[model samples]
Target: MLESLKFFILRFDRRRRFFRTLAPAQRILDIGCGTGKNVTEIQRLFPSLEFHGVDLLQDSQVPPFVQYKRVDLEDGALPYPDEYFDAILVVHVLEHLHRPLRLGSEIHRVLKKGGRVYVETPNWISLFIPSLAVDRSQMQTINFFDDHTHVKPWSRQGLYAYLGACCHLEVEKVGTVRNWLRLPGDPFVILAGLVIPNRGNVASAIWNLTGWRIYGVGKKSTH
Candidate 1:
């Protein structure tokens, strides 16, 4: 019931397409999976699907449902065989790398032909957010540099191009990720930001209005 409500408010159409596009996928990979949040939530909807995750985090830090592989994306290739995953997700992880696009080849190598990849990263607008990291502990990521790990920032055009040049990848779509339905509450979120000074959830709504994150999706060529 809660998930359905969020679907309507935060991301109705995009969420539908996200799940619908992957309904036929047999196996999926989440790159830079962090604490396995992506796979954890996805598993609820795809109990029968095989899920895998690769990240620099300790195996114990990730959820058990996923096959977690500890890998440093900067030093070496992903620890996976070619043509393995039917779907791959790289969300908010590329910026941490010094050369963001260096892993494109590895992504192409691991994803199956005709498989799809979804990549999202902080766009140029994310760089312009003011009052970056006021408290140091909270209210950070709204300003891209607040996360010192974010060495490289990306734009929609760059991500779109990376998919195409990343080897046998057919770029399907590129756009700023925004919850158009959330627009109505943006003013309240902005006003709350001034009063409560919380960049966590309050800023999320404002970011949606600004289209702070950009995304691109591409499919590996069968040939």
Candidate 2:
């Protein structure tokens, strides 16, 4: 329920900006597409483009335009031919895997030459202060580690290095989001000290402090 609500609140456009940079007619693959939320948004945004979604859990609600496949991304190969997709969306999913590099290599294999891939992961470096100040009980309620089935947390530099080692992809962009308060002291501590008790205030503080999340777009080398 919370996950669904979060998806709706984030809206599709906020996440699709990188993907929309490509020309129309590019085939897109969405890995770890939970509940088909983003897939539906993409369909509405690009009606003519082809979209494919894959996940371990099969949800009947998958959008009509999105062809959902049940598969474990941690396994050997993605169930698709080489150069099957021109663009891939991996929003907040790479952090959950045990072997992300292997999966990245597979993503590289399946993408067409000059294809683009957008990847996102929680900014662990940004979460340091917040995770420390917030009580574990409160933190657990927030599900910071729940959906984070990921084996290890990631930093922008760490992710770029790993992806670069796995494949000949260029790191186009790297930055954080959701932080807005720009406070001097620990934003989480300051947020926890607020009187009115703004829920989003903490998130904004984290973003300002740590760049909350890290996103990057990479293009497969044509060579």
Candidate 3:
């Protein structure tokens, strides 16, 4: 239920931004496509489009529209030839990668000219919750390694720099996913905080902080 809710809130925004460049792609590849959820969601939005997914596990319960393959991206190259895919999606996958740059290069090579890559990863800065009076390093460490497979968290700037450099892709947008739920009750929280010193700022800042998850879309350089 929680995962589904997260997906529901995130899906529309992502879909809107991602498909802005290529509304209807000829062929798309999804790297690290665990269960092909992204692919399934995208296929629903664009039913006629061709979708392919590559992940370490082959037991994904993917829909008929998606062609699923098992590939260890950290060890081997992407199976497709250069400039084959019209677009690619790499959602929530980078942190688990041991060789993310290599995958980025492969993504660059596989995408057709002007193709776009959409990526979302956990934001390291969000791990530090100042309001809760948590230790920064310890909190960061906990969040960073919450998933045992995660190599490291990526800051928004770092993600842009690495992907841009590795793929020569033009960055479209890079920002954190604001906590939408926190927005509505901020004024009340602020009011309450005035009675209690340092409470308002802490309450309001939670929503104002743009550090939950960093996401961006980049287009392959045509030249």
Candidate 4:
């Protein structure tokens, strides 16, 4: 029951909208596809597409649409042929690994020419919010670092530079999202920041200004 609730929340329609732009026949891979939440959504939105999921642990309840592989990305190689996938999803997984560059290169190795990769990670920008007195914690909430295996928390510049070095992928878009419910103090501040003229600028500024969270879609270069 708990896992079902998680699936519903994670499968937000807005998230699917971003992914549906990929071609329908493309083979999709989801790295660190915990409990197949994102994979299920992808299957629902693009049922005809081939979908594969990999994670450190295997769960019996993974949806029928997903082929599951159990492998520790931190300790071993991705067990697949080169250029195997047409697109890959790495949602909220990179920060938990020590070898992000190695994982990026592996993802590049598995992606066919002109393939796309969608990645989302917690924004290290949230740290800046506390510095600006917009939040109470001097750092991100406990959940941000709760994973014992997490090696690094990446800033936008850090993540982009790291991925760029491993593959010919270019960041096509960059954005932020709020993960926590706003409180009275910070909520009003965030609201005022949005209402101010040049709302995009305000939002971007606040987003970039803090160590919140960053997400991006990148297209693998064909050259």
lDDT of each: 0.79, 0.68, 0.71, 0.67
* Per-candidate TM-score against the hidden true structure: 0.91, 0.74, 0.74, 0.70
The residue-by-residue lDDT of candidate 1 on 7-122, one tens digit each, is 66744534335755677899999989999776776787778989999888888899998888888888648888899999999988888887656589899999898999988888
- Per-residue CA lDDT of model 2 for 1-223, tens digit only, reads 9798545545433355664565564688988888777667667677788888888875575666678888887884688999889888888777778877778788888989888888778777643544433433333312246334646567878778756777558777665544232335444554574554543455445544555577777888888
Clashes of 3: 0
Top candidate, metric TM-score:
1
Worst 10 residues of 1 by lDDT: 131-140
The alpha-carbon deviation from the true structure for residue 154 of candidate 1, after best TM-score superposition, in angstroms, is 1.2
Task: Kindly list the per-residue Cα lDDT of model 4 for residues 97-166, writing each as its tens digit.
Answer: 7766678788888888788887778776443443232333224232344335656677777767756776
Among all candidates shown, the one with the greatest lDDT: 1
Output the worst ten-in-a-row residue range by lDDT, candidate 3: 133-142
TM-score of 1: 0.91
How do the candidates rank by lDDT, highest first? 1, 3, 2, 4
- Model 2: which residue pairs collide? 96-150, 179-207, 179-208
lDDT of 4: 0.67
Question: Which pairs, if any, clash in model 1?
Answer: none
CA shift at 113, candidate 4, in angstroms? Answer: 0.6
